[model samples]
Target chain A: MAGTDPIHQFVISDIVELFTIGGDGTEGSGLTFSFTNSGLFMVVSVVLTTTFLLFASRNRKLVPDRWQLAGEMSYTFIANMLRSSAGSEGMRFFPFVFSMFAFVLVGNMLGMFPYFFTYTSHIIVTFGLAMTVILVVTIYGFARHGLKFFKLFAPSGVPAYVLPIVIPIEIVSFLSRPISLSVRLFGNVLAGHITLKVFTGFVVSLGALGALGWLGALLPMIMAVAITALEVLVSAVQAYVFAVLTSMYLNDAVHPSH
Target chain B: MVTQAFAQEAETPTEQNLDAAIDATRGEPVEGAVGHDPTADTHATTEAHGGEHDSGVFPPFDPATFPSQLLWLAITFGALYLLMSKLALPRIGGILENRKHIIDADLAAADASRQKTDAAIAAYETALAEAKSKAQGIADQNRETIQADLAAKRSAVEADLGAKLSAAEARIASTKAEAMTHVDEIATETAQTVVTQLVGDVSTDSVRAAVAKAKE
Candidate 1:
């Protein structure tokens, strides 16, 4: 039942329990050099992303084939997204935005595999990415505008008497951006995967009951299939959302105005 | 053990027997055997958590794997960023630029060739027109020269004919004057002969004066 449990699918189990420098070679010892399933999938995601981009553009034709078109489509998709949100100047952070989009997209897609772990479903990964974007935006904002960046907290149209209330509210909201950004992806992917596992578990458990159970199990199996399909769409949309949101944040950094 | 349980369940027909078997298997000494093998312990724990789903609830919150996940994420993302900025994007940009250059060059070459063709046509038209006009001018000059030459020839022929006629007329007039003189001498001789025969010789001076008055 534990193995069939939907929640267990997200577990980060050790693939190879590695050793530290010295001492009794165990898990929680000197240095944890353990490789987990989560890490394996992360590596897989990265390799897939690299392979796609590298080989897709190897021939680099004026006219593109299917694979090449897919590669270019992704590039332009992010490029256009950045332009729309942050303008041409925001293209300066193209490398960062593109990398994040590819990583998250690949991670989400790979998780659709039955046994593969979805790293983006993990809050740490999403948080790390979101924090990086926010950090870069903050740094760029300060570097570009210096003290004027703080003016973002107190918007231009605010009345002089309402500075204290409005400024604090704005500051809190600004700080909450990374939280909302990370949680949105993690929560969606996490819930979607969990729901799929639960439905799949129902198929197994219900079938175990008997002839009646077997007939009954068809419903959840179909539901599972449907959820899987929905999850696929969600995966793609989340990646888009992540990239678009990053572009918007970067836009704020570049402009830093009301 | 789970597979064995399932196989046994499949063999058994009744639901009660399957439930009993499941219950009996659940209370087995699997946890005690976990001390011998860590993998067994994990499996046992996993089986134990089947009814209660609390053991591996949320992995991202687990502090044990965070450092490793975070570490690798940083390394991978950083590498990706470097690869993107240095290699991938620039390669695409280069391909696009090259395509653009080729297109522009082709367009310019086409335009140049079109202009050259236009110029060639214009030149041919002008040459053809010039030749046509030149031929017309030569024809007009030739016709004029032929007419002038014919006129000069006609005038020379008329003057030659006039000279020959005048000479012929003068010759006739001289011949007529000689004959008339001869005629007068003959007439006087005959008249004298006839008078002499008729009545002793007629006078010669009287015959000559009569002949002269008759000529006037």
Candidate 2:
């Protein structure tokens, strides 16, 4: 009965009280600087990613050790993904793309632990990431191609008679990239966690009914274990999806035609 | 009994929560109910903490936490980007590049050594062939020299044997001539003796003439 509320885990609670600046730090009040569980996890993600990468590269062996190989593999994975989707010129944005990938992946992995806040489950966080990608695409597209960047919506091969219908659809699709990107990740993580919690809650509830209850609880327990494994896979896949999509969007900035 | 009561109490709230969730989805508010909606519970908790902005919303959908979350994200992500670009990526790339260079250099060295070995083998074969031909030439020269010496010695021996055979034939001819002379002498003496025994003496010239005439 205690952990039955699937929504309880997502509650944001402040760990340290800092200051309320403008109004009262409420809905429309102003900005609040107090460090919350979300902030702590963000800090944890940054530290963990930095330490792992730095420690892995410390040896610089020709025949790499396990940790070093792991580090190199992650680097190559993201680099190749960006280069293939975008282009070699897109290597300019490698730092940004790599950072986004590592942050999301590490954050998702950290959230797998009990009592850890999943930052990617929040729409604002994923939206912030998606918006940053869009902003880079838009700003770089304009800076690089000027007025010709609009050619993205009008694609080259379409018949002139269908331009009127095709242009708006293309524009809508282009504009919805950030929304789709953010919502896809957030919805997946949110739903997966909630489902896992609900199934686990069923096990606890059933186990309280004496011997018969204990026997019935086995099914839910198995289901909960299976769902946990699925969630782990989902977390990794979602992180990869975020990076791949980010590269594809950045590709538009590099080559805006088709 | 008490355990059973507790189990029943837990089950009742779960059923009520499910109904409240269904009702909330239908856009109908359940009135005069305590802890019926889970979001309401979250709302009460936030309100109790004097946070006015997220009082009646799901925590994820609440707008009040956006500013801090964004600020922290920018800080942490920016830090990650700086650390990676400056420190980690370049090092790994360098290691890979260095390994490639070393392996290539090693392959080239091995190729050069293989060529050297091939050249040495070819030289060794040439030397062996030359030695074999030289040995054949030496053997042929020795055989010719021995055959010539044998021919010379055989010719000298045949000449020496021919001279000895001629001398032996001359000696044999002389011995035959002497024996024939003795035979004639013996015949003359015997003739003389018989003549004397029969009737007085016979002359040597006559006897000789008679013998020569008889031999003729």
Candidate 3:
């Protein structure tokens, strides 16, 4: 079957978005409002997580079963991650970070299936998520530190005369966070999917063959399976990476050294 | 109904020890005795009878379940901690206490046995000493009689020996006199014979002279 227009399929048209309700000018502008493809996958991910947790908790044995142990490990892991990254100074934000973690984890997972659209592949979705996190840190930073957040762009080591040259560059670097965040996630996921698709096409297109031709088919097939497993790991890693970065920004916001 | 009651009476192995302890304290008769009763057990009986259980009990309970899996999980964990605290922990503690009591009783019994051993050893020693002293007394009594008899035999033998010694001395003196007489006679006879044989026709004086010369 023919593929959809890649440009239109995973392009960012409108600017603003978010999952959780927060004090913001734009809430769910593009995909979060309706029962779209992205929404379906989000629902699927939540349902799956809920089911697994439920089954795991049902027995309630002192010595946990395998699934229960996994659930417990995951909870502890995320909790510890939050504790280390955000520190005790920012514990109230744990649920939000955890929620974000859960959302991306599911989003990445849903995209991995064949004939499925990677929500993360879309820049708008990723940008919107990053912006929400960035926006939270920004607002909280301003609230807690007042006007002192401007110091985040200016370091102490730079000479007074160098402020004119250095401040703009720092400000641009700091402002480019959402762009980098969105692009990194989107590019990795899209590239992974496209690579898989291209290799898979070789497998089918190459007719049944001899030593050289069989290898041509064999290599790509192996790569496809390998990439699938890798994607699972990468998906979890991305979520963790996102959460950690969010925490760092929050840390910077709360305690701005420069 | 009888079968049902008997079946219920066949309590689980896990519960028997616990039930036995409870029955003991409650002044109830032991299980399998003549008056053993399934209805006697308070806890199991109460649960089975359920006199206070209403039909509307747990009305909001839903088997299909809401999206409260996460919430239920938290509740489940809390409930488990409670069960460990209330039921499982206390039973284990009671078992440990009983084991300690059994060990203490065994130690006390061992101490009593050691004391008895000590007493027995003392009694055996006292009997042995009395036996040894009685044997010594018997030996001393026998030694006195033997010494007395030995002295009497020695004195009688000395008396007999004195008489024999005198008789031997007398005999020796008489024998000595006779031997001297014999010696003189033999010498005179030998001289007469010798003279007769040497000089048959010689004169008496000449003979006497020859004899005197021979004697010299």
Q: Which numbered prediction scores highest in DockQ against the true structure? A: 2
- Highest lDDT against the true fold, candidate: 2
When just chain B is superposed on the true chain B, each candidate scores a TM-score of: 0.41, 0.57, 0.41
Q: Which parts of model 1 have CA positions greater than 4 angstroms off?
A: A17-33, A157-162, B1-57, B107-216
Task: Tell me the deviation in Å of residue A211 in model 3.
Answer: 11
lDDT of 1 by residue, B31-95 (tens): 32223323333344545444221233365676656666777788778887888888887776677
Q: Rank the candidates by DockQ, best first.
A: 2, 1, 3
User: Residues B1-216, candidate 2, lDDT per residue (tens digit)?
Assistant: 223433443456666654744543444665544344545454444545553334456779977777778878888877888988898778887887888899999999999999999999999999999999999999999999999999999999999999999999999999999999998999888888888899888898798778878887
Q: Distance (Å) between predicted and true CA of A134, model 1?
A: 0.7
Model 1 Cα displacement at A112 (Å)? 0.5
Candidate 3 stretches with Cα past 4 Å from truth are A3-34, A54-63, A156-162, A208-215, B1-216
Task: Tally clashes: model 2.
Answer: 1
**Relative to the unseen true structure, what is the C-alpha lDDT of residue B24 in candidate 2, on a scale of 0 to 100?**
38
TM-score of each: 0.66, 0.71, 0.46
Q: Estimate the overall C-alpha local distance difference test score of candidate 1.
A: 0.81
Residue clash pairs of candidate 2: A27-B53
Taken in order, the candidates have interface RMSDs of 4.1, 3.8, 20.3
Ordering by lDDT: 2, 1, 3
